[model samples]
Target: MNNIRNWLMGILAGLATVFLTVGGVRYVMAGGEPGEVEKAKQAFKSAGIGYGLAALAPLVVTILRGIVGV
Candidate 1:
């Protein structure tokens, strides 16, 4: 149970890291192009969502455990 939780946490953290890195690169390379800037903003939003999910994973798992009696 704990192993699974730890694995999920790691995956979510990795997703956030990847999105953040991509967003940063895009932003730097956008060079004031509005379209590119919008895309970069989307990547940043995705990164934020991933981070939020990672932060909530433990709490969510605990809730599931309670409901499922795991």
Candidate 2:
């Protein structure tokens, strides 16, 4: 059961990573005008930062949970 749960979590994480990466790339590609491109570029940068924060969130949560014995 634990292994199955782990597998599901891993799959979800992988999919999230793929979705964010592809979405960022697609936004950059679909930038139509100069202003739109700039907006997309900024969004891509923010998404990258968000991705980093999201990657940290689980680790942090796990650590806290372990510490709290939750």
| lDDT of each candidate versus the true structure | 0.91, 0.62
Tens digits of per-residue lDDT for model 1 on 1-70? 6787788889998999999999999999999999999999999999999989988889888998999998
Q: Which parts of model 2 are misplaced by more than 4 Å? A: 33-70
Cα displacement (angstroms), candidate 1, residue 70, comes to 2.1
Query: Any residue pairs clashing in model 1, and if so which?
Result: none
Candidate 2 lDDT over 2-59, as tens digits, reads 4544554565566666656765676667747666566666656665665565556666
Error of 2 at 47 (Å): 11
Return the number of clashes found in candidate 2.
0
Which window of 10 residues has the lowest lDDT sum in candidate 2?
1-10
Error of 2 at 6 (Å): 0.4
